[model samples]
Target: MEGPPVKIVALAIQGFVGQVLLDAGGNAKVNKQQFLHQVCKRIHSIGKNLFFEFKEKSFKLHFLMYGSYRVNEEKSR
Candidate 1:
């Protein structure tokens, strides 16, 4: 099945406050709390990795096999 359109994903996250759960990979020294209250400028993906772009910084999220994510959803017990 095809996933949602990129524009839809962007609309869901763009201009919304975001949080970082872990430091970004490679040499980037991204503080986990740095994204707090920052508006997400855009969202894109390459291969299995997703990216969240901000005004001065961007983050990458690499999903492993079978990995999944949810937006605006409560955690299941």
Candidate 2:
């Protein structure tokens, strides 16, 4: 089945961290594509954050910007 494409755009905020996007409500549209926009629409940040590109019945996530992060570190390096 073919239908109109869904467009989603999101902007990133500076120094924004510990964010999440949870689709608690299941898909209500006819198909997955219709309800997938919520992924990018529902985001918590200073300005804007989180993005998605719906393509071929799928989606691609993109991080416009990121906060500084490190792992595997000791108390004193």
Model 2 residue 59 lDDT score: 36
Off-target runs (Cα >4 Å) in candidate 2 are 1-56, 67-77
Write one digit per residue (lDDT tens) for candidate 1, span 1-77: 12344335445665454554332223345664676556666677665666888778778765555545566565577
Model 1: ten consecutive residues of lowest lDDT? 19-28
Q: Model 2: per-residue lDDT, tens digit, 1-77?
A: 01111112222332222232233222224344353333332423223333332232323232334422122333354
lDDT, candidates in the order shown: 0.57, 0.29
lDDT of 1 at 14: 52
Clashing pairs in 2: none
Model 2 quality (TM-score) = 0.18
Q: Count the backbone clashes (under 3 Å) in each candidate.
A: 0, 0
